[model samples]
Target: MGKVKISAVSYTNTLPFIYGLQHSPVMDAISLSLDVPSTCAHKLIQGEADLGIVPVAALPIIPHAEIVSDYCLGATGAVNSVFIYSEKPIEAIKSLRLDGQSRTSNTLARILLRHYWKNETVSLVSGGAEAYVEIGDRTFGKQHAHPYVYDLSWHWQAFTGLPFAFAVWVANKPLESSFIQAFNDALAFGLDQRDALIAELPPRIDFDYRQYLMENIDYGYNEEKKQAVALFLSLMESLEDPKAAESLAKRDLPK
Candidate 1:
C-alpha cells in the first residue's frame, strides 16, 4: 500500500506535533501536508488526506470520522489565540464576523455570546461585522487594538468550568494497528521536546511565546477534554436552529 497521507494545521500550537512527525521513525510511512485549519478539514473530508488535525467544529460535517490521536490543541483558561475583538463591548455589539480561518472558534464565540453574554441580536457575518472572531498566530499581541477583547477559552471555562478542545487528530477511516502505534509515538516524541521547540521559535515582543505554549495551551486528550467535547456538542444541539443542530449531530458518534 502507499504511504498514509496526513494533513496538519500550520500554526504555532501544532509545532510540536509537526516536529515529532518530521523527526520520528514513522516519517517514512506517512506523507505530511501543512495547511490552515479549514483546509485541513477540507482535505480530510474530501479524501485528499487519510488523516487531519482538524477543528472540533468540523467534525459534525465529516462523515464516519474518528479521533485517532491522544493529543489535542486545548486550553484550560486562556488560549490567547482565539479572541473576539470589538470596538464596543460584546453585549452592545450588533453584529459579529466569523473568522475565515476557523470553524471551532467561530462556533465557540457564537455559543458564548448567546448563552453566557445574553446577546440576542448578534448576527454572524462573513465580513463587515462590528465585532470579529480571530484565531491563530495573527491574534497574538493584537489584543490592545480592540476595546473589548473576549478570549473564548477563558470565557468557556468561566461559563462551564471545563477545558476546551480546539483541534484534534482525526481519521476518516481505520488504519493498521502498527500505524496507529507509530502515530502515537510520533506525537509523544513531539510533546516531550516542547521545551526545545519553544527555544527555537523566534522571539515576539507583543506576547510571551514561552508562556503561551507552555502555560496557556494544554496539549492532552484526557477525560476532561472528552467531557468538554461532549458538553460542547450537546450545547450545539440545544440551539434553536435545526440546521445547526443537525450539522453538529453528524459527529455525535458513540464514544
Candidate 2:
C-alpha cells in the first residue's frame, strides 16, 4: 500500500508529535503535511489526508474518523497561547470574531462565552479592526498583553470543572488494532522526550518555553482524558446538528 497521508498542526504544542514522526522508525510509512488547525481539519475532510491532528470542533464533520492515539494538544489551566482580545470585558462584548487559524479553539472560545460568560451574540471572523480572537504564537507580544484577554482553557475549567483538550489525533479509516497499538507506543515515546522537543523550538518565543511545555500541557489519552474529550464533543453537539452528534456520542471514543 502507498504511505498514509497525514496532516498535523504547525503550532508550538504540536512540535513534539511532529518531531516524533520525523525521527520515528515509521517516518517512511506516512506522508505528512503541516498546516494550521483549521487547514488540518479541511485536509482530512477533503480526503487529501487519511489522518490528522485536528481541531476537536471538526470531529462532527468527519464520517467515521476515530481518535488513533493517546496524546493531544491540551491545557490543564490557562494555555497562555489561545486568547480573546477584546475592547470590553467578555461579558460586555456585543460582537466576537475568530482568528481564522483554528476550528477547535474558535469553538472552544464560543463554548466558554456561551456557557461560562453568559454571552449570547458571539460571531466568528478572520480579522476585525475592532476586536478579535487569536491563537498560537501570533497572539503573543503587545497584542496579547494589551487586551482584556480571556483564556479559553481557563474559562472552560471554571465552567465545566474539567481539563480541556483542544486538538486530538484522529484517523479517517479504522486501523487494524495492531496499527492503533503502534501509534500509541510512538506517542508515549514522543511525550517522554518532551525536553528534547523543547530544545528544537524556534527562538521567536520569549517565555520559559521548556517549563511551559512541562507544566501547562497534558498529553495523556487515558480514560479520564477521554471522558473530558467526550464532554467537549457532547457540548459541541448541542450547538451543532443534534442528529449527527447523537451518532458520534454512541461511537467508542479514544482512551
Candidate 3:
C-alpha cells in the first residue's frame, strides 16, 4: 500500500542498477537506499527493508527469503575483484582477517581456506593477520600489490565448478505482482545502461572499468547462477552450524 523500501549496494559495480532505479517508472512506487553489501543484508534481515540486492550468504538467515529480481553481481571466473591478499602463501599463512563490508566474501574466504585450499589451521584474526579478504571498489588495482592474491570467485568455481553469484535481489516477504514487474523493468533498464554508466565514472589508468563491468561481472541471474547461489547458501549454512562444519572439516584434508 505504501512505498516499498529497497536497498542496494553502494559500489562501482552497482552504478548501472542505481542509474536504472533512479530513471525508471518504479522510482515513484518505491523508496531506495544505498549501503555496503553487509549493511544491505542487515537491513533486509532486520525488517528495515522490504527488498535488497543482498549478499547470497545472508539469504539462508533472512526469514522467508524470496529472490525478486532477475539479476545479480556474479562472475564466471577471475572476476578481477574479490581477493585474498596474503603476505605468505595460503598454506603457510597462520592468521587471516576479513572484510567488514561483505558477509558473503568473508564467508567465501573462510570456505575456501577450510575446504578448497585444505588449510584449516589458519586462524581468522581481527587485525594484522597474514592475509585479509577484500572486495568491491576497494579491491581495484590491488592485485599487483600483494605477493599472493587469490581470487575468491575463481577458487569457488574451481571448487564447485559453478559460476559465483555474490549478491541477488531478495525480498523477505511476498510483494504485489505489479510492483515486482515494475521493479524488474527498472533493474533491466539499469543493466542496459552499464556502458554509459562506466563512461560517466572518473577515468582510471590502473583498472579497466569497461572490462570489469562488461566481462568480469555477469549481470544475468540465469539458471546456472541460480544453482551456484543455492549451492553457496547451503555451504554457508553448513559452516554456520558447528556440527556440520566439523563434519565438513574432517573430509576436507587429504589423507
TM-scores for every predicted model? 0.92, 0.86, 0.94
Clashing pairs in 2: 98-125
Cα lDDT tens digits, model 2, 1-255, are 678888988877777777777777767778889899999989888888988888888888976888888788888878878888888888877777777787777777776776667787765554563356788867655444655877778777777667888888998886677656665666677778888887776765556677557877777666656667777877677567878656755765332
**After superposing candidate 3, which stretches have Cα over 4 Å from the reference?**
242-255
- Model 1 weakest lDDT span, ten residues long: 246-255
Q: Identify the superior model by TM-score, candidate 2 or candidate 3.
A: 3
Winner by lDDT between candidate 3 and candidate 2: 3
- Backbone clash total for model 3 is 0
lDDT of 1 by residue, 104-196 (tens): 888898888877888979887777988999999889899899788989999999988889999999999888989999999999999899899
Candidate 3 pairs with clashing backbones: none
- Clashes per prediction? 0, 1, 0
lDDT of 2 at 40: 90
Instruction: List pairs with backbone clashes in candidate 1.
Output: none
* Residue 109 miss distance in model 3 (angstroms): 0.6
Estimate candidate 2's alpha-carbon lDDT, on a 0 to 1 scale. Answer: 0.76
Which prediction has the highest TM-score against the true structure?
Answer: 3
lDDT of 2 at 35: 94
